[model samples]
Target: MSKPEFNSLNAIFINCTLEKSPRVSHTSRLIDVSKGIMERENVSVDEIRFIDHEVPPGEKPDMTEYGWENDEWPELFKRVMKADILVFATPIWLGDKSSVAKKLIERLDGMSDKTNEKGQAIY
Candidate 1:
């Protein structure tokens, strides 16, 4: 079989640092390294610092009740759906993934049954 052909490969790096403001995060730096590798391969890269956004913790995929598509998590999910690769970068905290990282996973879990325009599973 031949290798898959892609016009462009998009990657999203979800940085799950606990910092509340725009502070330098080690997790983000690690993502930068990975991003550089992807860039060398001609893949578009996008980074999202979870701590910088007000993403609430829940199993609801889209935040429609709270003003549909107005929440950051849903907007971020949109970007994730369009990407070919996804990287979840987070610093280990107390022998476990950061709280923000766990929360992001929970939010994404809600989209496990979602489908794309072509009726393919987004997860």
Candidate 2:
């Protein structure tokens, strides 16, 4: 068997650090490791630091009611839609995933029903 091909693959790493202005942290370290692995496979990588952005937490998926035009989530979702792979990088805090990570999941829940071109669920 030959190695799998990933020349056209694109990936996004959502770093869910709690710090508003996160400095070097464990979550970033994990992202670095993943980046190295993906780069070796020729996979394009993009990263998003949720804590650095104004990501308001709510159960609602779209932020239209809260002025979606100015929200960063819509743009982020668009990037996720275009990616072939998504890596959720979050540090476990007190036996739970980081709050930002949970918020990310909640935000994505609204897209769970949507399917990809291959008839697979996007979320």
TM-score for each of the candidates: 0.83, 0.83
Poorly placed runs, candidate 2 (over 4 Å): 67-70, 115-120
User: What's the distance in Å from true for residue 51, model 1?
Assistant: 1.1
> What's the TM for model 2?
0.83
Please provide, for model 1 over 1-123, each residue's C-alpha lDDT reduced to its tens digit, 9 standing for 90 to 100. Answer: 986543388988989898765688888788888888888777888888888876777778666675654567878888888888989988996789998889988988978988779999866
User: Which residue pairs come into collision in candidate 1?
Assistant: none
lDDT of each: 0.82, 0.82
After superposing candidate 1 on the true structure, give the runs of residues whose Cα lies further than 4 Å from its correct spot.
Answer: 1-7, 64-70, 117-119
- Name the top TM-score candidate: 2
On the 0 to 100 scale, the lDDT of residue 3 in model 2 is: 88
Best by lDDT: 2
**Candidate 2 residue-wise lDDT at 115:** 86
